[model samples]
Target chain A: MSFSVDTGEIFGYLGPNGAGKTTTLRVLLGLLSPTSGTAIVLDADLSKDDSMRRRVGVLMENNGLYDRLTARENLEYYARLYEVNRPGNRVTELLDFVGLTERAGDMVGNFSTGMKRKLGIARAILHEPEILFLDEPTSGLDPEAQHMVRELILRLSRVESMTVFLNSHNLDEVQRICSRVAILHQGRIRALDSIQHLTSAGKKTGFSITLADTTQASEAEDLLSSFGGIGEITRNGNVLGMMLVTIHAHEVVTTLVKNGIWVEEARIQKRSLEEIYLDVMRQAEGDVA
Target chain B: MSRIMVVAEKEVRQLIKSRNVMLSALLFVGVFGIFTVPAVLSGMGDTGAMMDTLGFYLVLTLGVFMGYLFTAQVFLREKQSGVIETLLCTPLSLRELWFGKVLGVTIPGAILAYFSAILIMVTGSAFTGQTLVPSLPVLFHIIVVIPAFIAATSGLIGFTQFILGMRENQILNFVIIFGIIFLTTFIRELTGPEFSVTWTVVAAAFGLALLLILVTAWLTRFLSRERIITTLSE
Candidate 1:
């Protein structure tokens, strides 16, 4: 329910459907007033200072574009609204940045969903705002387009030193681009931390080793069962997958080989952001129950 | 350009591109301007006064109707499309948005009103077998008072569109359309053959329109970004 994104940080607001992600963004952008408390941005309450909005850029679910207007006109209109210096040049620069310069004169009504989404992002950063708020920025985009948007967000943060507030349900996208994230469920924040800390926090690494012999698989499991630093050793056919708490994959292989068990293949499996996110949601749900 | 002019210029361009609304405004003016001239000529003892009164009130009436038609395109369409949500985030205040739209609707509405005046002059001369030009007062009314009335009416209607919900706005539109038609016809019937168009009447009408503009501009204080954003279509 509450967090602060540091300057030049790509803060991901991750949540399930109806988790108040969009509502939080709206409150911060001054589209909706908070019921009891205030939401501030840029050292000023957005609801109180109208001029502060000029410093922020927003791209909502609707993209805030006119279909009747051409792609060039759409960006030009916003450029003028934000009062970007040399609006004509900025519009052309953005069109090239989003790779829509070829279709600049085409009506936005005829644009595909991905094209429109790209244009929406172009419009959001038209003025090179200090902070950008994007809601599901990559929703309905193809893999290539999604990658392009992620790269653009990274470039904006690294090159422009612009802070980004991204609201998305795409955990993989968040994992790739967001430096930190807050997972919300049922109108409350269940977890908030850096990607590195949350993914590595208290979770043991997993490994699956393929034994050369079916008979050695059970022996491998039995040996690892009493192992001091390993947990949850399971055997399926010739494969032994287990959780490694303190032992390394190399140590597990050496221990098996020293016991006369031939190890065919050993692979390490790290916990993903998706697993952490789902686990947090389940715990939050259990608390409510 | 100033933010108000930016918004106003965009509205004007977009409304001009809206073919259906433009054709309807032109059709409304053409039909009433050409057909009603004969009706006024049939009931008049003084042809000049009859032409003058028709020019004065009819232009204002048509101007208001045109404003009504264009207001929906400028105000309601933006809300329905949910574009106003982003606009609310801009540096422009609510008053600037309202005034810009009022200016946008007035430009086209006044142009159509001027066309209607010319149609009346042509059709009235044809019907009476003599040319009739409106007096100086009537000319002033057509040029000045009609555009001011158009701006006033557009501002009021656009304000109501922003404040009210969708279903309530639909009902309000019906009431406004019928009210404008009834008032235009009722005022003509009330004038009868003894009515005289004077400088005082022209000045009084301009004064009333100016008052309406000021009142509507002041009432924009009640409009909030939250209200418009919440009322916007999802």
Candidate 2:
């Protein structure tokens, strides 16, 4: 339910539907008050100090744009609101940054969902905020658009050194960009760790081995099944795939080779973020049951 | 520019872009000014006094109505669209946001009200077969009092819209429409032929508007970002 993001770090907050991800964001952004707790942002209690909000930026599920205004007008209005010096130039620069200079004069109501999301991101970074909060920024974006948004977030973190608090259920996005993450389930944090640690530190590991001799596939499978750490052994066309518990790929290969099985390739597969998330959710549900 | 002015200017620009709303306001003012005067002033005995009185009260009524109409567009529309959530995150205080929007609505509302006053004068002159000009009191009322009244009414409405939920705002809209209609028609009929459009009456109306503005300005202290955010339609 609570965590701290380091400076210049992209902290991904992952949760399922009705998991209070949006509600938590609203509280942190000072839109809603917590019933019995405090949310502090930028070394100030968000509920008490209104001025602290100037240092923060938010892009909610809605783009928060005036559809009647052109893209240029929408950005300029927000730039002025944030009191950015040289607002006209800033507006132009942001338009170019988001690749909307040609369509800056177009009304945002005419923009596609991806274009709207791009403009929404541009609006969020207009003030050069110390911390940016984005809820589902790339939720409905096309693959290319999603790449652009993710690249933009990385640029903000690396180039601008901006701290980003990203709330999303996109496991690939979290794995690709976030250094650390907190997974929420049933209004509680089930796991909070660095992406490296979450994906690497788990007990279950997978290994895929290809045999030079097709006849040795069954032999290799039997050899791994006889081992204490190997589980769920499956073989297909001289390839042996199995789950490893408390065992390394080297040991599996060494045992197969010792048993007169020729191993052509031995590879250790990393568990994906999606796997970690689903495992955590399943555990949480079993606990509830 | 200061943040308050920034917010106000944006509101003005957005309101200007809303062509349908502006066109409707003009059409409503034109219809009422051209049609209503001929029917009401033709039945009167002292046409000049009646015209003067009508100009006085009618302008104020139209000005308030204009304020009501535009307040919903500027304040309530922003809240409904969820743009206000982003604005609230700015350093701009709740009062600044409210006052800026009220100022935005008042400027356009007063301009439309002025056009309505002119339309009333021209249309009344044609219907009565005499050159009718607004008296000194009516002139002051149009030039000074009507804009102030518009600002006050819009401020009150904007404040209420920020504080109340969607259902309450709908009810408030109905009340505002009924109130404006009742005052415009029923109060004008109460004045007899002997009623004179004097400076005292003008001064009294100005004082009342000023008082209402102060009261509404004080009411803005009750506005909070939490209230506005919670009232926003999902």
Candidate 3:
């Protein structure tokens, strides 16, 4: 329900539909007043201070574009609203950045959804705001377009040094780009931590081993099942996948080789963001029940 | 001031680019301006007086109608499309946005009103053997007072649209259309053909328009970002 984004951090907000993600975003952007709590950004209340909004940029689900206007014109309109200096150059630079330079003069209504989203991103960052809030930025985009958007978000954080609060259902995108994330379920934050800590939070480590043949994998699985600290062992062809609780990867590899089970490869898998998100949702639902 | 101008400028540009709306407005004015002049003139005894009367009431009606048409586009269209949420995030104050849109609607509405005046005059002159020109007061009304009325009308409509929900706005829109029609008929009946255009009448209309504008501007204090944003989904 409450959190703060550090400067220049790409904080991902993950939630399912109807989890009040957009509602929280609206309150923070000053489009809606909170009923009982404060939503602050940059040490100023955006709802009260008009000047403070000049330093912030936002791209909501709608993209806030005039379809009648050209792509360049849409950016220029926002650029002027933000009082950005040299709006012409700034707009052109952003058009290139979002890869819409060739279509700058074309009407936005004619653009594809990906093109519109790209143009929306360019419009949001045209003024070089200190912070940018993007709601479902890559929703409905193709894989290639999604990659471009994720890369762009990273570049904005790393190059422009702009703090980003990204709200998305794309867990892979968040895992690939965000430094920290908060998972919201039924209007409450169930999990909030860095990607590293959250993925490695539990004691059980996912470990996988590939052997030379199916017979060797079967033998290894049986051997590992007999041992303590290893559970949920499943064998497919020459690979043995399991979760290591009290055991270590080095011990497993040494034991396998000593037992004459040839080890082709061994990998320690980290928990994915999708797994963490589902866990949080399950816990929240359990609490509700 | 600059931000207000920016918003105003964007609205004007969008209005101009709306080809279908522009064409419909032109057709509406053309029908009333050209087709109705002969019938109204034939019923009046004084040609100059008839020209003044037509220029006065007809142009003012057309101007306010233009305000109505364009206010929906400039004000309600943004709300309907959810772009107003983003605009609210800008540094522009609520008054500035309302005023900017008012000016945006007024400029084009006044221009159309001027065109209507010329069409009425030209059509009346063609029907009659003599050149028909409005008197000094009527010209002043066309040049000055009509735009003020347009601003006033659009300003009030835009303000209501910002504060009201979609269903209420739809109802309000119906009221506006019928109200404009009723006012036009009522004023025509009240004035009769004996009504004359005078400096006093023009000044009084101008005063009323200015008052409406001031009142609308004052009413904007009640506008809140939360109110506008909350109504957007509806």
Candidate 4:
């Protein structure tokens, strides 16, 4: 679980529910004193002094806004807590950034879950913190809202050049934006690497070939067998299945046609992140079967 | 400009915006309106003048209101709304957090106490045709009494609520608050102590404040922290 987050890069802290994700963030924020081990954030010993929290933006799932205050008031309150000067303009900028400008005067109690989530993010980033820690940030957001949140994170990282440490149980959500991911289980690090490195190491690509007839299919299969990196080819009716190899997918089709096998269709199969996550978890549990 | 100052200001503004704050202010004012008549009658026969008698009664009024409002909102709202978690996440030191809350809640509360005192002075002046003598004793009464009352009320309310489970043990807390307020009033009325020994009252106020603080700390150390961590774990 010891890794560094580079500035301007998105890092996903992937783990199971209650796998110490929130606890880890809390320690980093200096809200919790670690029982053992160290949480070093921005060169400060988080356990010793929490003054660094002023430079960090954090959004917790279901951490509701003060229901009695307007959206503007809530932002102003956090800005003040972070000691941001001239909080009024910062409040306006954050409201606009979250598309909450129109609802700035409205009580946050009346807002929808998605709107509240957006506002929570706005409050966190109001002071332009150097790092952002978002825990299950898009838990209940719809697809479009999730996309907007992702885009917002990207914008913040690129424009502000901030480091983001994201904690989520959603793997696809991680893959969509994270430059790197660390998988955790049972209070230990199971896997830590860039997505490209891990996928290439532990996973095999898969593809389904849909052809016209058995003669063409057999011919394609024979050609594909000699074509380096096809694993366990299977056939039924006019369909063909194989685990793809280290070689680029286009190389396979080019090799097929050169061998006089008419090309009908070739597609590299996709593995869902959920499947990969399950595989990683099962491996951690010593239950490959 | 400082983080603690920001948090303190926000807390004060929040207390002001709540309906509970308005009602508490109005209740203290209503007490002044009612106490003013009797205060003036006492002043008509006084050698010391209206302001001195009015000042003592103002202290009494402030004490009761402080005891009541300190419990109703500051203790109840944070417990109910779940905002306490977010507040604790700030970089505010624990000492700063505690003092900030006490100050924020008490400032408006002190202003309300002063409002009642002014009402008493005005009514005493108008009804008895006696101008208030704003002397050193009158100043002493306000400076000592208003803050003592505020501190005592905060101690009583905050300690009981944070320790006894303000959200869960409603009946137990209500009984405790009722008993404390009732006993304090009953004892003060019976003591009939002289004004010069006012430090005795201050001592008693501080004693109550310290007890509340001790109970809050013990609960956090022995019980509340584990409960919060376990609940979040689940």
Candidate 5:
């Protein structure tokens, strides 16, 4: 049992293309039975307790949609399969959410790739599932469609507090949206952590002092770099950036004022998610090699 | 329960859209109408010789072609289109999927077979110059045996479709359709002549149908995200 996720989360499962993301989704959806390990979904082992799938939703990368059926019909078919409580209302809501209310009558075969994917999402969430497994939620989609999908997911996550297990190779998307991320490389988790703790590694914990002019910035940089605790001081435009490698960040006020550089603003460089993801993958590759 | 039916119904609807299947069904029915129906009507002809020589030729050649297409392309289309990936991630088991597919083809195939049989009877009667009313037993045989033939053929088709990966290459599908036809005859001979073609086919159909159900159940034991992921990573 997981110690966390009880409070709800959008956990991103990051990996390269063809990294078994689809296969993992299959197992979660109970389409495929695992040979050895126990599959626990929604606190129940899928192998033993088959009923758990009823509470879970899955949007696989490929839509096994009935191409002959209209979009509305496709959703209706899945809605019945998932045993949705309010079939008509759910269908309407899903169609509207996916922005397919206009094309509800069109056959799935006629819908564009993105439209089909949106329909897939609608089908996945129609059952009001407690958990959703979305494999590459925005892959192959246009930028506009990608934004729509992202916004919809954020809305759903915030409002429903739904546990979303998103699998994707898009690192940027993962970094921007995921509250927590797990990197899977070659059938194992390379790393799993929150965004904040991951990027704060091997860096001076100090604030930057913003000056009004580049002349002030260069002077400040020279003065700060000379100080004993300040390791490396650089000037970015009017900003005096210093890496106080040894001293605590709180000591910046005293160090700056003593150096005669009046500080207008103080801030630290926050690490980006891409930086952490690359670091973890590099570590994993090194360890494996 | 409802999901399986939805899947099966959708498959049936797709049949209407397939120009290839429609053309194949029409060609097969037309051949039945042209050759056998005429021969049966001409009772002046030798019935035994026809059943022995021409009938076997027809059933083996055309039946195999039809059977192969029924099994191979039916599911292969969905697989190639990447649709199988969608439903496989559902709560549905493989057993239900197989049944839905079998029915999807069997219903339409059976209807086609039934009409072909009607042409056979009408032509046979006209040729014989007598009321060739089949007895109740024969009628029962026709009803039971004909559907069984189609069902069994569809089952055989399903196995080949799965084994051959019929979805991608149309050339492979042609090779498989003919290959299974020849193999069915070979497998039949190995089982022995005491079981005639009808019995052999019937038994084989029913038996293979049962085997398909089992294979599906067993294969599912290893299916999961691991399989897809492992495959992709490789």
Candidate 6:
């Protein structure tokens, strides 16, 4: 329910459809007043301090654009609102940055969803705000466009030293870019931790091994079945997959080789962010039930 | 430029580019300005007095109607599309934003009102076979008082749009359109053939307009970012 993002960290907020992610975002952006607690950004209450909003930028799901205006005009209008220095130059630079230079004169109503999202990002950081908040940044984008957006977010955080608070349902996107995350359910944070810790710090490590032939796979399966600290063993053709509870991947491979089973490949698999997120959601649902 | 002026400038530009709206506004003013002169002259007595009366009530009515039309575009459209939410996140205060949009709507509404006034004068002169000029008081009403009234009317409507939800605004829009039509008809009935434009009438109208503006500006204190935002979804 309560947490703080570090100065320049990329914090991911994950939740289901009705988990109040947007309500929290609205409160943070000063659009909605929180009922009980305070939502502060950059050490200032955005609702109370008008000037402090100048240092923060946001791109909600709507993209906040006027369809009647050209792409350039939309950015220029926001640029003037922020009082950015040399708004013309800044707008041009951003149009180029978001790869909308050729379409600058075209009305945004004619633009694709991806194009609008790109322009929205450019508008958000037009003033070089200290922190940026993006809600569903790559929601409707194609794979290539999604990749470009992900790369842009990473570049902004690393090069501009701008803190990012990304609210997204794209687990793969978050796992690729975000350093830490908070999973919220039913208006409360169910799990909050670094991606590294959540994926690897569990008691069981997912380990997989592929043998050279079906005969060798059968021997390895038999060997792993009799071995302690290994459970849930499943096989398909020459591949063996199981959960390693009390033993390490190296020890498993060493034992197989000692048993004269030719091990073609033995790999340690880290649990994915999607798995961790689903586990958290299930736990929360179980608690409610 | 100040942020208020910036917002006003963008709004003006957008209104200008809205060709359909501009065309419709021009059509409304053109039809009323040209058609009303013959009816007024045929039923009235004094030529100059009739011209002055036409200038006073018609131009004021046109200005107010223009304000009503553009206020929906300048204020309600943004709220409906959720662009206002982004504007609220900026450093500009709610008062400044409301004032800026009022100015934006007022400028265009007044310009259209001016066009309607000139059209009325030209059409009247062509029909009467003599150059007709409004009295000094009527001239003051068209040149100065009309724009002030436009600003006041648009400011009040824009304020209401910012505070009310979509369904309420839709209902308000219908009420306003009907009310303007009824007021126009009522003005025609009240101004008999013997009625004359005088300094007293001009001064009283100007005072009323100034009062409306001050009242609208005072009413803006009740506007809040939360109210505007929460109504966006509705």
The prediction achieving the highest DockQ against the true structure is 3
lDDT digits (tens) for residues A213-253 of candidate 2: 99877767777787898889888899888888878888888
Error of 1 at B68 (Å): 1.3
Place model 6 in a CAPRI quality band: high
Residue B68 miss distance in model 5 (angstroms): 3.5
Which residue segments of model 5 deviate by more than 4 Å? A1-7, A17-37, A200-210, A246-266, B1-3, B35-67, B118-141, B159-176, B179-234
Report the lDDT of model 4 for residue B88: 55
True contacts kept of each: 0.76, 0.75, 0.91, 0.49, 0.47, 0.78
For candidate 1, give the docking quality class from DockQ: medium
Backbone clash count for every predicted candidate, in the order shown: 0, 0, 0, 0, 12, 0
Measured on C-alpha atoms, candidate 3 has an lDDT of 0.92
lDDT of 3 by residue, B169-214 (tens): 9999999999999989987886696689889999999999999999
The whole-model C-alpha lDDT of candidate 2 against the native structure comes to: 0.88
Tell me each candidate's TM-score. 0.94, 0.96, 0.98, 0.80, 0.79, 0.98
Q: Tens digits of per-residue lDDT for model 5 on A139-246? A: 999988888888878877999888888899888777777788777776667777875566676666545778755566767766666667776676678876667677
Answer with 1 or 3, whichever has the higher TM-score: 3
Pairs that clash in candidate 4: none
**Which of the two, 5 or 6, has more TM-score?**
6
* Ordered list by DockQ, greatest first: 3, 6, 1, 2, 4, 5
Cα misplacement distance, residue B3 of candidate 5 (Å): 4.4
Which residue window of length 10 is worst by lDDT in model 2 chain B?
Answer: B186-195
Kindly report which residue stretches of model 6 are placed more than 4 angstroms away from their true locations once superposed: none
lDDT of 3 at B101: 95
Q: Residue A95: error of model 2 in Å?
A: 0.9
Tell me the TM-score of candidate 5's A chain: 0.87
* Ranking 2 against 5 by TM-score, winner: 2
State in Å the error of residue A12, model 2: 0.8
